[model samples]
Target: MIDHGLQHPVMVELLKKALVDEALASAPTDRSSTDTRIALQTGLHRKDVRRLREEPVPEGVAAPMVPMAANVVARWISEPRFLKADKTPLPLARTPRLGHPGEPDFPTLVAEVSRDVGARAVLDELLRMGVVSVSAEGMVLLKDTAFVPQEGLGDSFHFLAENVGDHLAAAAFNLSPDRQGPPLLEQSAFSSELSADQAQELQRAARRLWADVLQQFLMSATVAEQRSSSDSGPKQRVRFGVYFHQAISTPSLPAEAAQPARRHKKKPTS
Candidate 1:
């Protein structure tokens, strides 16, 4: 927020708005809560609550939490049909072959995720993001193991917000007073004493582990999506992710150096 130039007042307003929305959602739907009740819950002024309530909701501007290009890339690297025998993503033709109706290709990949969006458009986006490379013969290759976009600030920020927000949400749900079922899986490994080189090695190891985990999870999720297509019921989204961070810590004083000076026995000497 500081980088974005948002000030304390802006943060307060955002927090108040979020709290009010949460309170409203949790309240009984049969009866609408009064402005007083909302203000009490959100700690905003009654007038502010009324004004916020009356304000028109900005419409049709929301972006997807997960970009379609990302889904395409994930499918490319995870789905068996799109992967080589060695588990790496297979290079794909720009379009399906003339007679190969069921063959996996770039167009088919995008179409499976969303029919409304055209494959050409998605391909252009992936190209712009540097997620994929195209050959002179109209073949697409997955340059990155994941959709960590090298270009496009908007997509980068979108992933940052989506991943971090979901992570925090899981932690919050675990701490909620009325949480049900087992707590969402939220655990981390930490070790403070490590050389910088060791930290770098650990990060590389984490990346390798994440690659395997991502492939396994995506495969399961793809199967689940296919199985649930015919059923008419509520659906839930899940995000399982890993992050690694390392920083140098200030060195602490040794026990001998940290101890106070001992007083001399001057009186006994005299």
Candidate 2:
């Protein structure tokens, strides 16, 4: 068996980077002696081993509790989260065509389509992230009821990156029944429907949320890594705090009908 201990030092460092970010990241938590043994036995640079021993801890990435922390950070920085405003799953977006209502089994379908490796990983992530979660009956439930509409949590954020510029979409992947392993993953976002105002509102809401949270997120990544990680407990209290948007069929108000604006006028000699 290939003793992972003796793998490459750079490889070990990559794993360590993952562990610090909590971004589905990875790393070595073993002893330096064992690492050194593995290094020499495997002919990896002792310097690399040293780097692993002294790997700079990253922050705000939740905790290498997941995997691939670096990539997750990349995803987040490029697209924080693009919410959808539809209560329904993303595919029932029929415009003057066939009308149907259903979840469309996105999780399963995505799992199957990409052979359930990477995409399923994202699906599970959406669950763990509490964006979408598994219920008692093994059904997926939208965690945030008031997020207005359901945005494709993973898709849009990544899609925006893929479509507009020189993009290399991630490889397709799937998961096992137990849902373990590095995840065969593909991620992108899609929209169901959008009226002019709804679209505008989503944009505005996204903007506001981004403005409020982004600096904090970046700073968290930078600073949280420095302090002893004791903030998880407090952050848990913020559960259900994030919102994802989706489009819905809402009654549109005429442009004229709105909150009455108070008119200011020159008062007569009162």
Candidate 3:
């Protein structure tokens, strides 16, 4: 859950226009890139959207963005959550250290939060991707970031990205969870076309696409639990990292013609 703060109305509107119904929704066929659509929705020049969307995935994308966002955005966009299971009340379970922006290792914290949510594996995939960063001190921290403004961020790109990352971190960890996909990128194993640099590029590209999905979602909440909390106070500042776990590639089996058989022992004749 996120705290939307006094800018709730603005954030919601941004969600509607820039995210869900972005610019490319109406763009002519020549340019339907999601990046272009984000530009249309956010009122950002296409150049601005390009900058945010095209920025490479940061050094430690896979580590723990949600943990950092949850802590950083709490004053602006979250509620402190104690780890708990479905049949148990969170307050009755374990509570994380709160009111501190220095974040916990979300994957570990989430493992402590809810195993059914698969937050740890989801976080592992993110670390494999190289988008979010974690410090040696075990703090879940946001890396330096660039932002793409849609309708309302104005000069507040990082603030929005941080919240966006926070929201996705929750979606992947705290809220309704899914397999979050290949948390890291892999080369075209089936194809030998990828050079080392090209494979790296693919990884970076995937991370951006994932982050874009997050940006639109955070701005779209209307009556979200966390947003309601933030709206009652002065907006808090936060940083975020959008993560995507790359799909684990499955190895192909050899052709039947190429298959090898084990030698069988001959039966003795009576």
Q: Write the per-residue lDDT of candidate 1 for residues 1-270, one digit (tens) a residue.
A: 888788999998778777777777788863668888888877889998887777777532224533778888888888898898989898888977632566688888887788988988888888888888889877898996877888766677777877898999999999999999899999999987898888899999999999988999999999999999998999878888999888888789999989998987766654
The TM-score ranking, best first, is: 1, 3, 2
In candidate 1, which residue pairs get closer than 3 Å at backbone N, Cα or C atoms, i.e. clash? none
Best-fitting candidate, scored by TM-score: 1
Candidates in order have lDDT scores of 0.83, 0.43, 0.44
Model 3: per-residue Cα lDDT over 112-134, one tens digit each: 43455554454343343343344
Task: Tell me the alpha-carbon RMSD of every candidate.
Answer: 3.7, 22.9, 21.9
- lDDT digits (tens) for residues 143-205 of candidate 2: 432222134434333434333322221232243344555753344454555887877787777
Q: Which 10-residue span in candidate 3 carries the lowest summed lDDT?
A: 86-95
- Comparing 2 and 3 on lDDT, the stronger one: 3
Best-matching candidate per lDDT: 1
Lowest lDDT 10-residue stretch of candidate 2: 87-96
Which regions of candidate 1 deviate over 4 angstroms? 30-32, 59-66, 97-103, 251-270
Error of 2 at 163 (Å): 17
| Shift in Å, residue 79, candidate 2 | 18
TM-score of each: 0.85, 0.21, 0.24
